[model samples]
Target: MTAAKVLVAYGTKNGSTAGIARTIADALGEQGLRAEARPAAEVLDPSPYDAVVLGGALYAGRWHRDAVRFSRRHRRALSGRPVWLFSSGPLDASANKRDIRPVPGATRASMRLNAREHITFGGCLQEGAKGAVARMIVKRGGGGDYRDAGQIRAWALGIARELTDVTGGP
Candidate 1:
């Protein structure tokens, strides 16, 4: 039997989230699922996929505007399906590996849609890629690329396993 299709939709400002989405999609594909990564704004409908992995970059405890918009616009359809949410913009300077909760916008949508999971990943900070406010924050927070590929791959694999259990994909 063919595996269920999964959509890995993401919203990004400096493109880190997009890269993460693509990496997740690739990892999912390796785990025997059909997964496609696309910008959340480009997806007008959530009807085509059996499962969704929605993610967005977080800034000051807020999700990207497009991701929030997509979640709101597709809330009805999304509620009926298996959906997962992720936040990909936390600076991991400290050793704390506690789960990062979704932003307020995402939390509301996840409640309405009953999203299955919400995972937060570390983000990257470039030299000159941020706005003035963000730049200042980065200067204060210290800058570096904090994304962990192994962690991301493991998360994607777990999601693939969950999808397979739910859909009985081959």
Candidate 2:
């Protein structure tokens, strides 16, 4: 039997969300799934994967535009798969401390795709990040890498287990 192929697609600002997506892909691969990470904007099709993990970076309580468009653009293909959604924002410890609900955009996408789950991970802002607001945050010393790699890996592993259980593959 063949292993399930998973897509870890993300929309990111300052590249932090992309990092998380890569981590997820790596973890899923470690669990015996074939997973790849790609920018949400670059993926023209979602039908090739058995499962999809879609994520976006949040700003001002909104998900990234690319992620939003991806969900709308590939709704038909995605709806038929086991889909998971995530938001990467909250540039503080709050995300680790509590369960941060999805932004309105993510919530709507989840509903539209019948996503299996949604998560909000801590965001990162640092020097050299694009945009005036990001630079300002960094200048004010409010920027840092807050993503928890362990948590991200655990999430991906859970997905791997679910996928493997259903597929009867390693």
Q: What lDDT does the true structure give each of the candidates?
A: 0.84, 0.92
Q: List the candidate 2 regions with Cα displacement exceeding 4 Å.
A: none
Candidate 1 lDDT, 54-166, residue by residue in tens: 98898878988988888889988776788888888876733137777677988976887788888888887777756886687677866667788888888899999888888
37: Cα error in model 2, Å: 0.1
Clash pairs, candidate 1, are none
List, residue by residue over 22-139, the lDDT tens digit for candidate 2: 9999999998889999999999988999999999999888999999999999999886789999899888989888998888999999999899999999999988999999899999
**TM-scores, each model vs. reference:** 0.92, 0.98
